[model samples]
Target chain A: MEVVKKYSETELVQLLQQRSGNVFSYLYDNYSGALYSVILNVVNEEELANDVLQEVFVKIWKQIDSYDSSKGRLFTWMLNIARNASIDMVRSKGFQNSRQNRELSEDVYSAGGTSETKTDQIGLRKVVYSLKEEYRVLVELSYFQGYTQDEIAKMLNIPLGTVKTRLRTALIQLREIIKP
Target chain B: MDIKAYIESGVIESYVLGMAESQEAAELEQLSRQYPEIKQAIDEFEAALEKQSLAAAIAPPAGVKEALFSSLESEFKKDRSQGQVASINWGRYLAAASVILLVVSSALNIYFYNQFKSTSTAYQSLLAEKNTLIAENQNTQTKVLDLYNSMQMMSDPTVIKISMTGIAGKENNLATVFWDSKSKDVYLLPNKLPDAGANKQYQLWAIVDGKPVDAGVMGTCAGLCKMKNIPNASMFAITLEKKGGSATPTMDQMYVAGKVG
Candidate 1:
């Protein structure tokens, strides 16, 4: 982790309200990687993910005032924006027309060439890859795709109760893998 | 609150993954606010999810960060320009106010200065008039005292008063001589006489037992003037001479003559 300078949540909120560019730049430097990963995971294409990533940041900058600190962490709100923007992009006609040539089952992380070379350099990335495919796919659909439990159940053709249990199990497994 | 039952409900995980239904999310938000255990569970799951996302972190194309920053910079620059315009408006107001103040003060200064100058001129003229009146009043007072003394002299019986009529073809010129025999004092009062030329004055002479003795030169005499006393003088005469009187009288220049009775 690149230990960027940290600000308290209150200070961060105030800075964002002021629309301070320095804070925004610091936010881009620290969180863009994670946001890009979530974006890349949803759209599963490099060019599409890049376009979606830009839209996500622009929306965040333009609509930062709507963020409510009481609702969730700043990162969580940004993640929701990124996931929603990526999902919206994936549904667009242009993306559908362009992406029809590629199979849906293609690996999401296979496009970023640096991920393969740098996977060994970062310990957390190697640890997360050890996550079982069954639970990883559940985490992806629920978290990165912004799918509601009902939607996830219908899409996966599982019971509504099973969708919740499976997402919970996926989170627990990820928690185990993420622990130091 | 049963922390174990709440943890087993999978609501925390659903909330963390953004998979919770609107109602479920609302209920979880309320529960989290009420129960610290639910909040803690959600935070833990969120942390795990964040970790997993970070693991998948791909350095975004470098161009995206530049593009995002440039957009923000342009926005801030736009805001600053508007701010400058606002500040410029206040500057214009201040400049106009100061100009008005300067104009008003200058006009007031000119008005007051003109008033003061006119008042000072009036005061100077009034002071000059008062000085001239004081001088004239003093001259009048001197004349009144002289006339009063002359009246007293005329009333004394012992004082000899002689009226000298103009002689030498000058009949209109007249003079008076008052003699106090006991005190041997003589006073001449020059009356009508031709105007003296420049550098010339009227001189009076006394005849002491027939010889002429110089008395004194006289100017325009509107009052009594004491002449030199000649105790044995039998007659007196007036003649015109240079500004400073001569050693001897010019008998041919005699304008008036009188004899003691």
Candidate 2:
């Protein structure tokens, strides 16, 4: 049971900029769970998700110097990296060829089921599952699946304007549901 | 710009969720700086998303972390090796330098420890000497204060100074008694008296109407020694008696006597 030292956001960024390995370890220990969940949701396979998570951290370490605090928060930046890496793995030629038979909807359903079983400890699966079907689908596509608003609009056969508003409404609803 | 309309347009949400086009995101970033409300809206959404993501976290398989760290370490090693061809030579030089440094530091440690030990010993002795000097100073101050008080008492108009000269064969023995008639307090100064040997003490006696009343025994003091108070005494005298003082004065051993003038 090693004691983990806590750092404020500013201090963490400063240490990270100084290229401290210990701060990187702290970052991984604290945020890896959430990053893994997002990665798993996108890749939908444990082995591939693991590889994506590793790649995401490596990218985070390498790109830390370029991180702009004014643009967004550290967690948000890392989340973006994780989501991008997971999406890249899923859209790769080998991954799509292997799972070509499975429908994208079935992939989403299986991803949801996998997340439900894996994240039972936190019980946040219920929160996402509890969303209205339309809002939940929009959130899963735009957020977890890393689909562009335009792509989601085309895929769901909805107007681009409708996709944008519904995605916003879904997030607002999520904010309300999770508000303390 | 209509800030409320811009907010309701869902641009801030799209920006936070990373779904906005690059052009749209760039525009939002610029506008957020100009408008605080837009910034607040973006921040609120980002916080909400972060909280939800955290609540939805799943621990990765155990060996993943170990494998990831080892790979990172190996990558670091590969980079170092690739960058430095003469690293082996540098490693040998570093090892030799560190060995010398260790020996030098150990020697310095022993030297410093010895120096500290002797310094502390000297400091302790000096501290003890200072305490002894302080005690001696206090003793001297007390003697000086006693002398000053005695001088003050003698200068008072109501105090009569009685000089008791040695009686008969003990003529060299002399003492003085300062008697304050207003307060009837008696103080004695054994000016030139022989030390009373073991098992004996010098005692003072005050005579009232020709009857000698025992005063008190006199202890050796550097300054005036206070004796028993006598309201009316015609004479004061000192005599050598038993260590605790006799009830009646030994008229034969009367060393000094003086009439109160």
Q: Model 2, B1-261: lDDT tens per residue?
A: 999888777677677757778999999999999999988877777777777777677888877788777777754554434436467778888999999999999999999999999999999999999999999999999999999999999899999999999999999989999999898999999999997999999999999999999878998765999999999999999999999999998889999999999
Query: Quick one: best lDDT, which candidate?
Result: 2
Clashes of 1: 0
Off by over 4 Å in 1: A1-7, A10-70, A89-103, A107-129, A145-168, B1-11, B30-36, B47-158, B167-172, B194-197, B207-212, B219-222, B247-254
Q: Residue by residue across B1-261, what tens digits does model 1's lDDT show? A: 677887876677667656677888998999889888888777776766676666667889998888777766776554435667678988998999999999999999999999999999999999999999999998888888888898787678888988899885899999998888788788888877788899999888998878888888886544778777767788889999999898899878999999988
| Fold similarity of candidate 2's chain A to the true chain A, as a TM-score | 0.84
Candidate 2 has an lDDT of 0.82
Single out the weakest 10-residue window by summed lDDT for candidate 2 chain B: B74-83
DockQ of each: 0.39, 0.22
lDDT of 2 by residue, A55-152 (tens): 99899878988888898888889988987888789788898886665676764455445333454234233566678888878877777667888988
Candidate 1's C-alpha lDDT?
0.75
Pairs with backbone N, CA or C atoms under 3 Å apart (clashes), candidate 1:
none
lDDT of candidate 1 over A1-180, digit per residue (tens):
443559876787787778776777777888889888777666767777778888888888888899887777777888888878988887788877876544433433342453233432343334435567666556655665556677767876879887777667766665666653
Which window of ten consecutive residues has the lowest lDDT sum in model 2 chain A?
Answer: A115-124
- How close to the true structure is residue B28 of candidate 1, measured as C-alpha lDDT? 90
